[model samples]
Target: MADFNYAFISLVLLLPLALLIFLYLIVRPRSVNIPLKNRHVFITGGSSGIGLALAHQAASEGARVSILARSLKKLEEAKDAVRLSTGIDVAVFAADVRDYDAISKAVDEAGPIDVLVVNQGVFVPQELAEQDMDEVKFMLDVNLLGAFHMIKAALPTMKNRVDRRPASIALMSSQAGQVGVYGYTAYSASKFGLRGLAEALQQEVIGDNIHISLIFPPDTDTPGLVEEEKRRPELTNIIAAGGGRMKAELVAKKALNGIKSGSFIIPCNFEGALLSVATAGLSPQRSFLMAFLEVVTAGIIRIVGLCFQWVWYDSIQKWHAQKKRT
Candidate 1:
């Protein structure tokens, strides 16, 4: 009986060990390190907030940085800020991401980009019933289509970059992209669209040594978030409060580190990391250890995800009940 029990315990341990070995072998694309130093890192929406912070981080890391935005004044200010902080002068381009022609022109002028950070985004928080169609379209245009415009413009040059090193395209997606949130229907849709873009684009660009990173940052303390909070629905605020928020600088640092490491899914916080694993799906994973963790934790994470949903729905129901009482 004791021998049988020992064998059972051994089998249990071996099962996971075997699974880990299997996952390590099957993980595709393999591990890679995309260095940022001496590379040209181009960022959009770099006039302020996370974009500006990314510009500063990239420049400080020894990369030649370039910032683009609609306002030349803000772009100049961002450039000066980077220079003051890092003593590295970053190129500034004035253009709107929604305008393909303008973005294409800016990309051409910026030359071959080693790292293209599609950081431009706009959000208006309102329920689908109350949201303006124009605002919905605006979010889709700037957050989703704008990414298409920037990527389409930069791909050719990025593919032909003289450096021939591993290039990166990092998309700034929100935690809302991972899961639908109340009063963020349009905004979430736009951010969700980025995941599809990143997944498919990775397949297309892998041959060119271009890696894709989808950065998922929870509510970040940025100017955009400040504005968004002012207009956020009470229910939306209540539901979103659980994810917490990170400073723009901290988020940027996390994003840049993820880009440099060629990580496919860059989660800025512990919650974001759990979301990434829960939503791993068929996304390419380079790190075998992460793959193992994803596989092992899948069931538990799903239960946790369901628990979160329960709480969110409970909050919604109570909120409505309170409204009825009032």
Candidate 2:
């Protein structure tokens, strides 16, 4: 009996070890380190919030940074802030991401970009029944289509860059992108669209040594979040309350680090990391260890995800019951 127990324990230990070794050998698009130093890092929506923070972090890392936004004044302000903090002057461009012609002109003038950060996004949280069509269109245009416009404009130059080093295109997606949330109908759709774009774009750009990173930051303490909170539905706020907020600078630091490491899914906080693993799907993973963890934890993570759904639905049911009582 003792000998049988020992053999069963050995098998349990050996199974995981074998699995880890197998995963390390088969992971595709193998790990790469994309150097940021002396590279041109171009960011959109860099006038404020996470975009401005990314500009600062990139400049500090010795990259030639350029910021673009609709307001030239805010862009100038962001440039000055980076200069003050890092003593590095960043180029500023004024253009709306929704305008392909203007954004394309800006990209052409900025020259070949080694790193393109598509950080522009806008969100208005409301249930589909209550949300206006115009508001829905606005979110889709700026958050989803804007990303398309920026990438379409920069792809040619990025593909032909003289540096010939590994380039990066990082998209700023929200936790809402991973799972649908109450009252985030239009907003979530826009963010979710980014995942599809990143997945397909990676396949197209891999030959050019261009890597794609989809950054998933939970509720960040940015101006945009502040504005979003004011308009967020009660149920939306309740559903999102479980996820903690992160500072813009902290999120930017995490994002930049993930970009440098060629991480396809960059999660800012602990909760964001959990969301990434739970929604790994068929996304490219460079880290074999992470891939192993995803495989091992898939079943338990699904249960945890279901538990979260239960909690969220419970909150919704309670809120409706209270409304009926009132």
Candidate 3:
């Protein structure tokens, strides 16, 4: 019994070391670097907001940038904006993502895409019972199905890149995608679908050296956001209060950095970082260190996540009770 106790200490110490080595060598994520310079980067919804900002950033980084949107005028404005900001004249393509044929033709005209950013989304925040079915369909068609169209059109050439360098496909999700919120039912469903798409697509394309990045940005200050705010429910305003808004430029910068590094999950702020850890799930990791962190902290982060859920539930209950009294 004395010998066993003495040896137990050494065994415990050796176990962690052995596990770490296993994680580092056998279970570590595969490292990939998806370069942006001189490569073609196609961004949807690039005429405004996050997409436009990403276009400007990519052009500044010497990528052959292309902006796609439903509005010709907006695309032209985006082109001029990029030219003025970065001295790079980006190609402009007008196509609605809901129209797969138009997206296909646009992809053909754009030549080959080394990086594709599916950044277009629309949100009309209201409770499910009060929301129009058309609005719900619009969100799904644009936010979720649109991503499918863009990737389907771009993948063949992206997979066959002669340069043999890594390529990236990024989907612009929302923080709401990670967790359901007060008034984001339609939008959340659409964005949450992207996580599943990104995960499965990564498995499908990893052999071709194509990587996927799912970017989750909180409330971003943009023209669309102003419109959304006017229609936002009071309960939603209270529920979404603390996340704070990120400027489009900052969000774009974080997104571009994540794309370049081939990050599978790109969280855009401090709260987002916590959400990322808490909801990491089965998302692929390409960084060994991040994989280790996920493994080590999964349990604790889940507990934290549950605490957050409790707070959210409490808020919902209080809001409902207050309404009853009124």
Candidate 4:
């Protein structure tokens, strides 16, 4: 009985990954006929993290890739890294996601793109009461406004491409956008907006052969992750209790496959994917509130455990070691 139960759960879990992979395999030649080969793939915030990882993936898949970010040095490094990994030459452009003109310039420089991935974002943790105006504004500008500028400039060419294969757009969002979390008011809002944009764009472009995918990745292990942990306040212990962080490679693979599959909401994490599919079927009002409450509640519980461990466990462990020596 136990074995049967285990198998059932395993199927429940692996079923989704298999299904997504199958979707990608099924759509590879039928929908796009190109498999991203010799295609111009443009990625925002591609200097590092998942964006860079996706650049590497696209390179390996035979795509001529270009990445845009704000740091020239980091962009060079990322280009080198992708070159090392995939033996492909990738172009790096320094452009701020928030600037439409700058993004337009970068796009022109890269030329027509076959696949555009908007993966740039910012996470500002602030409470509504404290209203860290600077952080909140920066988050809105980078996470929301930046996405808008990139999409607006890329849509024209994406829709009217003269290439053999139709173009596709992938927007990188997060589980936080799928649900609300404490101290992530602005971040959540920006992601939710991206979610909305992808949905509307997908609908409006019906029969145009232009695909749009909204990706919701959970907290992933990346360079930005270390910074988040270092800056994390004691209160953030609450959110730290879930599964270990996701990897950039895993999330990037999912994003690429999701785009191929024309998935409406691509969850970057397994748990996130399950929840996304489940909630996407429900009313938006109920789904958002429920998801929000779950994030907040889990965060609080984890933080409480962290506070207790800090208060009592460290000293106890040290004392136990001394007693053992004595």
Task: Please name the candidate that would achieve the greatest lDDT relative to the true structure.
Answer: 2
TM-score of each: 0.98, 0.98, 0.94, 0.75
- Candidate 4: C-alpha lDDT: 0.74
Per-residue CA lDDT of model 1 for 54-89, tens digit only, reads: 999888889998899999998888888888999999
Estimate every model's Cα lDDT from 0 to 1: 0.92, 0.93, 0.90, 0.74
Cα lDDT of candidate 2 equals 0.93
| lDDT score of residue 287 within candidate 2 | 95
**Candidate 4 TM-score to native:** 0.75
Worst 10 residues of 3 by lDDT: 20-29
Question: What does the lDDT read for residue 229 in candidate 2?
Answer: 91
Estimate the Cα RMSD of every predicted model relative to the unseen true structure.
0.9, 1.0, 2.2, 9.7
Task: Please identify which of the two predictions, 1 or 3, would achieve the higher TM-score against the true structure.
Answer: 1
Which regions of candidate 4 are displaced past 4 Å?
1-34, 281-326
Lowest lDDT 10-residue stretch of candidate 2: 236-245
